[model samples]
Target: MYIHFIAIGGSAMHNLALALHNKDYKITGSDDAVYEPSRTRLLQKGLLPKEMGWFPEKITANLDAVILGMHAREDNPELQKATELNIPVYSYPEFLYEQSKEKTRVVIGGSHGKTTITSMVLHVLKYHQKEVDYMVGAQLEGFDTMVHLTKENDFIVLEGDEYLSSPIDRRPKFHLYKPNIALLSGIAWDHINVFPTYENYVDQFRIFIDSIVKGGILVYNEEDLQLKKLVSETTNTIRKHPYQTPEFRVEDEKTLLQTPEGDMPVSVFGSHNLQNLAGAKWICQHMGIDEEDFYEAISSFKGASKRLERIAETSKAIVFKDFAHSPSKVMATTKAVKHQYPKKQIVACLELHTYSSLNAEFLREYQGALNAADTAVVYFSPEAIQNKKLAPVAEEQIFNAFDRKDLQVYTNPEDFQKLLEQQHYEDVVLLLMSSGTYGGLDFNKIAEWIK
Candidate 1:
């Protein structure tokens, strides 16, 4: 198959490009801008476009399909050309659906735990030597590509993102999956630029629940009140299974789960992760994996990349980096670290990097999110706001929004680094939360300084 990707530098798009290229399909792509590691990876695979800007000539009749990334606008030159030629165009999620339509799609969806849940399922499947096609949001250990597609794999595990599929495709990406087995981790309002109201953001999940294939099973987080209500009201033909945080105890900072067979020690911790474990367990059971097998396989599962990933650690202090820009994610991560290391002084620093987090209206949702930390710091770059075309936000506004009078806010990374360097690190757990790098601060350098 010959396929072209518009805005191919995207994380998912580049991964998909590499996956298809490895499959020996003729792959071509174009983007206005490309950054590392997508740029480096694509170049290594010989998939990177020779030049940066889009060229209408890249779109032709012989191409089997055009996969559009979210970065591309509706009027992107190649997109326009493809439309002009009536060539088949698929949003990244839409194309994924097209590729895995014949397989049993197991989609993991929610505001926060999607990546972790998807990673857990993939880890267990790989442990059991189960051959499957898959797409996970984060780069995981022992996995070469975030996306894997094969004709022979009968199952496909998809990390179902609720964001808009593409600039032109307004439907939430998860809606297109139509999974036979689906999991909703939880619902928290996000993507303020798209869905203007919290109710509107929640309605997407309801729509996603409605979109499941007939007789499909939905394994959801019963602890989330909103999700519980939504699942209860849904009279769809699918079967509903709810999971909460499983019985677990933290001993010496290591989390162990109480399973039917015995107590199984795991590499991941936190109530959120425990809930993720429960949901993944249910999904694995549906996939014909029994409780014993699931526990054995999951014992080796560490975690998804950047979802509470340990960056550097010393006997005196430990540093963790998490991709947690949303309010719910921030709270969950903070609470997890504190619960895991109650004796340590938790110093949590978060970057308000996402559009939702930086927006004036959406900032209020973050109230008390970082309150679990002994010391809370919030960082945002004015340049980022300008780049996102968002109105400038003041530090006071952030302080008020978080409802923390003592919240230290920073507009500079260097100053933030100095603050960390000056802190007493003994018996402390430093949690760095952000979807973006904390204004490109060298976290390793900061970690060394703290150590």
Candidate 2:
């Protein structure tokens, strides 16, 4: 098949392109601008666009399909050209679904922990030498590319995101999956830009629950009251299973899971992670992995990229970098680190880079999120707010929102960097949480600080 990608520089889009290219398909892509990693990866695969930006003249009717990325605007010349030529155009999720339509789709969905849960499922399956098609949000340790597709695999594990599928298609991406087997980690309000109200954001999950294939299985977190309520109220035809945080103990900063056989130590820690692990276990069992094999494989699962990933660690101190910007994520991450090392001085730093976090009204959702940290710091760039066209958020608003009088806020990245540099590493847990880099702070330098 011959395929052309619109906005192929996207993380998911580029991965799909590479997956297709490996399958002996002729793949060509275009993007206005491509950033690091994506740009280099595309180049390595010999799939890089010869020239950046769209070329409407290249959109011929002979092309089999055009996969659209959400970053591409509806008015993009390439997209318009493809439409005019009557070539089929599929959104990223739409294409993924089309390929896996015949296979059992196992989609992991939630506000947070979905990536980690999906990664865990993939990790367990790979360890057992069980090959299956998969799409995960973050890069895993064993996976060369984050996406894999094959006609032989009977099942496909997907990290189903609730964000918009594409610029032109406003439906949440997860809604398009229609999974035969689905897992909802838990729902929390997010994407304030798209779903303006918290209630509206919650309704997306409702739609997602309804979209599950009839007679399919839905594994969810029972501990989450809101999620439990949703499951109870749902009239979907799928069989429902609820999981809770499993028994575990933190021993010498190591998380030991209490299994039916015995205490098994796992590389990943945190209450939320434990909950995610339980959900993954249920999903894995449904996929034909036995309990013994699931436990054996999951013991070696470290975690997903940038989700409580340990960057630097020593006997005295440890530093972790996490992709946590939303209120629930920030709160969970901060508490997880603190719970892991009760003796250490917990210093948590978060960057408000997302449109929701920068909004003054949404800031209130972060109330008491950083309470677990001995010292809490929040950083935001005024330029980002201006670019997002959001209202200005003052330092006072941040302090008030978090309900922390002594909370330190930084609008300048240099000041945050300096503060991190001067930090004493001894008996401390430095947790840096952000989806965006703190003005491109060099993590290598911070890793070197573990003395």
Candidate 3:
């Protein structure tokens, strides 16, 4: 089979390209620009376009299908050409559904815990030597590509994102998966630019629930009232399974899970992660994995990349970086770290990078989100706002929106780095939370300074 990608430089797109290439399918892709890891990986697989930018000439009748990335606009040249030729076109999520239509599809969805839950399931399955096709949001340990596909795999585990499937496909990505088994960790309003209101944002999850295949199972976080309401209202022909934070305790800075075999020590911690583990456990159970076997495998799971990932550590201090820009994610991450290291002084810094996070209306949702930290800092670049064509936000507005009078805000990366460097590292933990690089600040350099 031959497949062509329009805007293949995306994290997920490039991974999918490589996965298909590894499966012995002919893969070709074009993008105006390609960045680091994706570009490097594509070149390594000999899938990188000889030249960047869309080429309508590349779209031919012989191609089996054209997979579109979210980065590509509806009017993208290659996309227009594909439409002209009447060649089969698919949004990434749509194509995933097509590939796994005959297999048991397990989709992990939620506002915050999707990546962690997906990673946990993948880790447990790998531990048991279960062969499965998968697409996870984050790069995980022991996984060469974030996406993997093979003819032998009878199941596909997908990290279901609530965001749009493609520029032309306005529907949420998760709606296309039609999972035989699904998990929703929690619901928190996000993507202000698209959904606008919290109620509208939540409606997407409800749609996802209605889209599940008949007789499927839904594993959801019962602690979230929104999720509870959605699940209660759903009349779909699917079994509902509710999960909450499991029995766990922190001992000497280690999180131990209470299992039938006794307290099994795990590398991951926090109420959010524990809830994620519970959700993943239920999904694994549905996949024919027993609780004991699941716990035994999960005990060694560290975490998903950039979801409270430990970047650097010393005996005196530790530094963590998390891809947490949304209000709920920021709150959970900050609270989790503080709870995990109660004795340490916590310095939590977050960057307002995404369009939703920078929107004036959405800023109010972040009220007191960082209050758990001993010291809280928020960063935003005026240049970023301009680049995204968003209305400029003042530091005062951000500070007031957070409702934290003690919060420190920065518009400069150098000053932010200097402020961090001045802090004494002894008995302290630094958490940097952002979806984008903090104005291109070098995390390794900052780690070295703190060390």
Q: TM-score for model 3?
A: 0.98
lDDT of 3 by residue, 1-451 (tens): 9999999999999999999899899999999999989999999989999999889999999999999999998889999999999999999999988888889999999998999999999999999999899999999999999999887788999999999999989999999999999999888888888998888999999999999999999999999998999999999999999999989888778788888888888888888999999999999999989998998899889899999999989889999999999998899999989988999999999999999988888889999999999999999999999998998899999988999999999999889888888989999999999998888888878668777
- Worst 10-residue lDDT window for candidate 2 reads 442-451
Between 1 and 2, whose lDDT is larger?
A: 2
Query: In model 2, where do residues sit more than 4 Å from their true spots?
Result: none
lDDT of residue 285 for candidate 3: 92
Error of 2 at 87 (Å): 0.8
**Full candidate order by TM-score, most accurate first:** 2, 3, 1
Residue 383, model 2, lDDT: 93
Error of 3 at 441 (Å): 1.0
lDDT of the structure predicted as candidate 3: 0.92
- Model 1 stretches astray by more than 4 angstroms: none
Cα misplacement distance, residue 6 of candidate 1 (Å): 0.6
For model 3, the stretches where C-alpha displacement exceeds 4 angstroms are none
